[model samples]
Target chain A: MLKYFEQLGHKLIEWITIAREFIRLFFETVFWLIVGPFKDKPVNFKSLFFQMVFMGVNSIIIVFFVTFFTGVVLAMQAAPQLDKMGAVIYVSSLVSISICRELGPVLTALVIAGRIGAAITAEIGSMKVNEQIEALETMAISPVRYLVAPKFLALVIMLPCLTIIGDASGIFGGYVVGTTSLKINAGLYLQTTWKFLSRKDIYTGLSKSVVFAMIIALVGAYQGLKTKGGAVGVGRATTISVVTSFILIIIADCILTGIYFFSDM
Target chain B: MPEKEIAISIQNLTKILGGRKVLDNVSFDIYRGEIFVIMGGSGHGKSTLLRNMTGALIPDSGKILFNGQDLLKLSVAERERVQRRFGMSFQSSALLDFLNVEENVSLPLVEHTKLSPKVIDIISKMKLSLVGLQGFEKYYPSELSGGMRKRAGLARAIAMDPEVVFYDEPTAGLDPVVCAVVDQLILDLTRKLKLTSIVVTHNMESVFRIADRIAMVFKGKVEQIGTREEIRNSKNPIVQQFIKGELEGPIQIT
Candidate 1:
């Protein structure tokens, strides 16, 4: 029991150390992003543009396909339950509300955590292992300013935009099911989606996506910068980054959802 | 020995890694325009010492005084100001893989200076040419040979015209011919650029060829420091064992 407690204590300490470092990295990136431009030491916007292209533009197809299919599944499942209640027309509202309020943001974040999150870890991990990060330091360059800040900015901006796209595609998928399979009128379907999908629902999802974006970017960069060993280390960091981001995204979503659900917002 | 200007004075520098003293109170002075080589077998903390001096790894304790200003005592902004005068060439040539050679060389210049792109381009070309990597400017690091990569790394290190240049195992994984070429470049650049060069390596041949003075580290300590000839004739058994490449010595193989 004593040995187990000792092991537990060590694990706790390790986790705390990691958390501290991660927080430090996050704040440092934020500091650079905010203060860099005024000092004539701006976060490299050219690199930021490239990162935006990779993290945002490149991710559209995957986000579209995933959410679209999810929308189709949601509509299909809801049709039967509503049919039994003699409320088959309510399928459109169910699909849109859920897609905008819950599914779109969560799914898009998960995909990004797997895609761009893994990429960030792999790239930075390899750089860390190769001593390129140290080289940057020796050149009086902050790796956070040069690498992570741009990535953070790009992801923060792009993830919400992607979520909006995901929401649209998912609702479109539901539209297909409603009009074709359920034989609902086309105009009514869109009207029902708009009616049920309040501005609050869309904003809440967008806000959740922003937080999720921060989690993915920071977690990926933190793991990447912390990576040691060699090729194996990069692989391990990438895995942990994705897994950690996934967990954090869900936890954050739950907390935000709780806040939104419980409190009068 | 008469009043040579000290470029960098390392005072009782100690660094502990994984609860082990990787650098145990090591102290040394590297004079301007001299090639100071820190040579030791693998894992004796030579690289760690280099890292400490270059400000890549902060020492657990002790001072790295660059021209009498303590690096550790400075504010982050001041430390960076001092750091801008130093450049480090990594063993793996750690060039950003995505960046072509010209961009890699121009990185320090681009980051530290507000030079126009045209001037940065010209300066990068000059630095590349100094390392004999002129025409390969457009080629990415992945496309370069090991020797060319090292050269490109060297070009990047010198981009800022730094006062002190640290080379971590510059010729570690090169063919003998390429190793000799790198050694010659180190010697030529040291003279031509008038830069203080600190090299960390276990490559004995390159050490003898390029180093004005050599410091042999053993068990996280500076076992001996001397001129090449002095080190060649040193009475220290550990130094002799290392220089002679003998199996039986004070240094345990384990």
Candidate 2:
């Protein structure tokens, strides 16, 4: 028991240090974002554009399919149960609410955590190993501004855009299921979705996308900048970054949902 | 050159990595407009000291004084302002693989300089030509041979005409012919650009050929620093072992 507590204490301290580093990278990235335009180098539009295309444009197809199938699956499972209760019409309400308030942002964030988060960590980790990041420093270029800033700003903008798309794709998938498979009235399905869904729900979900984006960016950058060893170290960083981003996204989702539930947002 | 102004003064800079003293109270002065090489065996602290000099790695203690400023003591913004004129060549070249040679060479200017694109282009070409990489401007770093990649990196390093250029093992993995070419290039460019150079290398031949002076690091400490003649005729056992590539010496075989 004593040894267990000792190990627990060590792990706790390790996690605390990691969290500290993560927060530092988060604030540093944000500070770079605010001051980026005033510097001699200014904002790197070329890299920023590339990052948006990489993170948002490239992620659309996978996000669409994942959310689409998810919507289909959600409707398939929930509709039958609701239909047995003589409340088949409520399926639209359930689908729309889940997609807008939870599924869209959360699923999109998870997919992005697996995809873009891994890529960011690997790319920066490789740069660190090769000393390109240090080369940037010696040249007076903050790796944060040149590397993390573009990706951070791009993801902060793009994750929401992807979430909006995912929300639409999911609803469409649910609509298809409702009309064809579930045999619900099309007009009623549309009407029910419109009646139940409010701007607050959609706004809340989209806002979660912004937080999730920052988490992914910060976790990836922190792991990457702290990477040592070499290629093997980069692989480890990529793995840890994805896992940490996923965990943070889920935990953040729960916290935000609890806040909205209690605070009337 | 009689006054021999100090370009960089490292005062007892120490760095501990994983509990090992990577840079143990290293102190040296790189004179203005000369080729200064830091030589050591593989595990010694030459490269670490070079990293410290570049202001990329803050030491556990001591100071790296450059341009009337201590690099370790400055804020991030201030360090970057001072680093604007610095240049570094990495062991693996470290050129952006996605960018072509010309683009890599022009990165510093494009990011920092207010020069017109047309003028930047001309300067990029000139710097590439100086490194004998003019014809390979369109070739990406991945496509270039090892020697050619090093040349391209050097082209980029000197593109800004930086006051102090740091070269980390400029000819680590190359043939004798390529190594000679690299040595010649370093000599020619440092002279032509009138820039002070701090080179970290364990290559004895390269050091004797290119260095105006040499600082030999042994077991994480600076063992000896002097002119080529002084170092060549030094009484230090570890320095003699390192420079001569001998196994039988005061340095314990790990």
Candidate 3:
């Protein structure tokens, strides 16, 4: 019993230290993003552009497909129940509102957390192991400023954009199911989606996506920068980064959803 | 000889890593424009000491004075100002594999200078040429052989025309011919640039070939510090055993 408590205490301290480091990295990254340009030490725009392309553009197809299928499944599941109430057309509103308020942002964030998050961890972890990061320090370069900030900035900008695309594609999927499978008119389906999806729902989902982006980028970068050993270490960090990002994204989505639901905003 | 000018002074440097004293009470002065080699067997803190001197690793307790300025006491901005005059070559070469040779060499210049892209390009080319790597500027690091990668790393290290260059096991995984070539490049660059070179290596041949002075560290402590001739004729058993590459010695391999 004593040994168990000791182990638990050690684990708690370790987590606290890790949390502190993670917060520090986030602030340092933000500092570089905000202060670097005035100091004539701007985060490299070229690198930032590349990260945007990789994280946002390359991810579009995957996000679209994932959310589209989800919308289809959602519509198919909702139509049968709503038909008993003589309101099968409500399936359009159900799919669009859910996609805008919940599914689109959550699914898009999870996918990016899998893709970009893993890549960030692997890239930074390998750099850490290979002494490239130390080489940067030797040259008076902050890896956080040069490396992490651009990634953070790019993800912050791109995730919301991807969520928007995911939302549209998901609504299109719901339209397809409602029009063809359920024999609802296409115009009525579109009208129902537009009517149900309010500005609050759209903005709330975008806001959730923004928070998820920070979580993914920070967790990935933190795991990466602290990576030890070598190739195995990078692999381990990548896995942990993705897993942590996934868990955090879901938890954050739950909390944000609760806040939006109860706060009456 | 005129009194040697001290470039960097390490005073009672100590570092602890993973509950072990990786460097303990390490003190030395590297004179200006000299090749000071820190040599010891594998896992003996030679690299750790080099990292400390290069400002890559912070010592737990000690002062590293570069040109009479204590590096540890400086603010980040001030430390960075001091650090810009320093460069390091890694054992693994540590070239940004994503970048081509030209871009890799130009990294420090791009980060630290207000020079235009064209000027940075020319300067990076000049540095690569100095290391005999001019023609390979377009090639990525993965496309280069081990020897070429090391040379490119050397080019990048000297790209800023730094006041001090720290090399960690420059010839660790190289063939003899390549090792000689690297040693010759180190000598040439140090002589031509008048830069203080601090090399950490256990290779006896490379050490003797290039060292103006040598420091042998053992178990996180300095065992001996002397000129190559003085080290060759030293009375220390650990020094003799290490230099001679002998199995029978105070250094027991477990």
Candidate 4:
């Protein structure tokens, strides 16, 4: 038993050492990638464009559909409850505030975490397994600069864009639910939603989306970059990146919401 | 040969994994424009030694000097800069299945050079043709046969026109005919391009065909370093056993 414990301890230490080296490589790559664009070498606009298309354009449809469904479900659930309290007219206000302030950004991030996060992880992991990462290193190109930096920048830029679209689509969904299903006046619904929504709410949602984007991008890239073994390792990293990003986004949403609500109270 | 132009000088190198020594105080030097081969049986640390020379793995002790500068002492960036002078072909080919022959061959140029895509495309096509893979440029790795994939990998390795190229078991998984083609390619590249090549292989035929000098690694240390004739004439019992493929040797298979 003691021998087995010792073996386990030794393995743990080895894993930790590898993890430390991975972290160091990741940060070092990030530093060089940040500086690479300004160096003597010209920036690669083609790579940047590819990243924008992958991180932004490819993800829009999923974001739009998910946000729309979330809005519809929230309105449908809230309508009866609001009617019970004789506050049926304020259903739009509740839906808009919840969806815009929290649901829209968090749900959209979750969708992207599932879609784009997995892709980044799988792509980088495949590069690692195939030794293309090693090839890049051999060519005096920082793999992080050539690979991870563009991904990071793309996600950071596009997450907010997706969030804005999600916010609008979600509101539109609530309008559909209220005016069609609940027979509420469309003009009154819009007015109530406008009255309740604030600049702080929008800004807060966008800020959370930004934070979630960073986490998803960083964690996904980190996991992918650290992948070893081969095909099996890449697959495992992709799965782990999606699952971890989803859990972290939810946890972050709770904490942010707690702070936002309690501070106001 | 001038001492200043030594491509690689490894001294007193040691590597330990799981407290077992993988390479023990191994030392060797590779001169410019020479085909140096490291030969050993399976699990004899030949690949480990190659990886150490390439700075893919750092030694627990000793130095790897590339062009007189200690490769291990350099930062990752600096090490990578040194690595640019070398290219490697992995045993498994390691081709990107998603990328076609042209894109795969152009990877190094795309990553490290500011050359326009048109120029890169032309250079990529040239490399493919040089490897006798001209019309197959649009085919992905999965679409190619085993031999063609290896040729494509070689094209990629030489795309940057590296001074030194490393081949890890280039003939391992190929038919005899394909192996001959690969061996001929290695010879042609060395002679035509004046490139220093280090090949690790257990294939005795490959070693005899391409190696200007051969180093035999055994149990984490170099057991012999000599020309093919010198090695064949060696009186060392282990060398005799290995070269003759005798099972009754001092090298106990574990």
Q: Which candidate is the best by DockQ?
A: 1
Fnat, model 2, is 0.84
Residue range with the least summed lDDT across 10 consecutive positions in model 2 chain A? A35-44
Q: Rank the candidates by DockQ, best first.
A: 1, 3, 2, 4
Runs in model 1 lying further than 4 Å from the true structure: none
Q: How much is the lDDT of residue A246 in candidate 4?
A: 94
lDDT of 2 by residue, A27-93 (tens): 8888888876675556688889999999999999999999998888889999879978999888888
Interface RMSD of each: 0.8, 1.3, 0.9, 2.4
Q: For model 4, how does the per-residue alpha-carbon lDDT over A65-176 read when each residue is reduced to its tens digit?
A: 9999888998889888989988988879888998889999999999999988999899989888877776566556666776777777778889999999999999999899
Per-prediction fnat? 0.91, 0.84, 0.91, 0.41
For candidate 1, give the DockQ: 0.88
DockQ score of each predicted structure, in the order shown: 0.88, 0.77, 0.87, 0.46
Candidate 3's docking class is high
What TM-score would every model get versus the actual structure? 0.98, 0.95, 0.98, 0.89
Which CAPRI category fits model 2?
medium
Winner on TM-score (2 vs 4):
2
List candidate 4 segments past 4 Å from native: A1-33, A41-43, A258-265, B1-5, B75-77, B96-99, B114-122, B241-248
